[model samples]
Target: MNRYDHKGVSHYEFLERLHRWLNPRTYLEIGTLKGGTLRLASCPTICIDPEFQLDVSSAANREVTLFYQKTSDRFFQDHSPSALLNGPVDLGFLDGLHEAETLLRDFANLEKHCRSNSVIAIHDCIPMDVGQTTRINNGGLWTGDVWKVVPILKEYRPDISIFVFDAHPTGLVCCTNLDHGNTILDGMYGEIWRTWRSTELSDYGFSRLIEEANIISTSRVETPEEMRRYFWL
Candidate 1:
């Protein structure tokens, strides 16, 4: 069985460290089911989820916190991230859907409201095994086909920089050097969906992804300064 051994800090720990170091002015999170990661943000936060099991007290630290209980697509259609946040999102986390097409749409929508320097973190882009990368969640540790987003971005949005960190569990893909005005992804969304929708990890070559991804160890950027310089923050 093909397996990925991620020997680094957990994704949650990494996010906590990132929040403390980056200290973004405004934060946006998709798929905040229980508000574990939502609690990390001290800045004004916008959370979108179809259904949330968040605690009322989890958002007490933020001066402003907006919760939208709807699918990401619906939320984007009804509201604008920048307008709601009162400015471009400084740091956005995409963890809404496990499907590649859905994540791609989420990324495209979020990118339009982010500045060039904004950082967007994509969860579950690295699956531990082929089983974890399936379209349906058979059982435990299901990352789904979200791993497809890494290669999709590399091939389509070459201008953006993607850093895949070996955070515990699945992995964390941090995208930087965003262009809010870039319409490349938006224009080709249909084509991209058609191209990648039916492609499985095995057919795409899991080994190829592992090699091309150049997954980094979180230990290398244990400190905030190192993390900042590594991602060019």
Candidate 2:
């Protein structure tokens, strides 16, 4: 449940919602380092990573269909944005090469797969960390240019909602609310609490987002029972 257990919101929170929203039959992961996050998603997965260093015979082995390759090239042909996604992907987690060009390329490929309501979750987007610094090494090829995709997205797809999870050293960017076909920017905070505190969340991932919103509200730990109140059982 804790992606790295650094004591932020549990990463499993969103998958709980996916269980209710789409009940996704297939899941895909771009990076499979030890399969920590991939396994928790609890669905059959197609994963790619060039140097993941995961043991093929370990407990995490059976849950995944591993692909050994550079994720970006395998996902797209001709390196064009239009060739980015392969399609019908219900859940896509981007944790591959962190270069801006690679991320931009990944985003393009993802467009083909994401449904109107599909969730496109990007990891390591929490301000600055190992993921953000790598691109700067390449003369800011990825770090500088990847965020440029944000404005491009807002321009081309004005309907999608963007929410950033408030976990430092590594965070998540959640692109949601494009499914219901509504064109309003009504910020829907997932009230993921069972007792319905005006401040608490009824679900997990969304609750994590809420908790992030109130880092100064309180430093209380959220229990699993409290998490179940807002999400799938």
Identify the candidate with maximal TM-score: 1
lDDT of all predictions, in order shown? 0.90, 0.47
Report how far off residue 12 is in candidate 1 (Å): 0.3
Model 2 backbone overlap count: 13
Q: Whole-model lDDT for model 1 versus the true structure? A: 0.90
Give the per-residue lDDT of model 2 (tens digit) for 117-211: 56676665433322333334554322322333343345555666655554433445656544433322212212211112222111323334334
Q: Per-prediction RMSD in angstroms?
A: 1.2, 11.8
Candidate 1, superposed: residue stretches over 4 Å from native: none
Q: Find the candidate with the highest lDDT and give its number.
A: 1
Cα lDDT for residue 174, model 1? 91
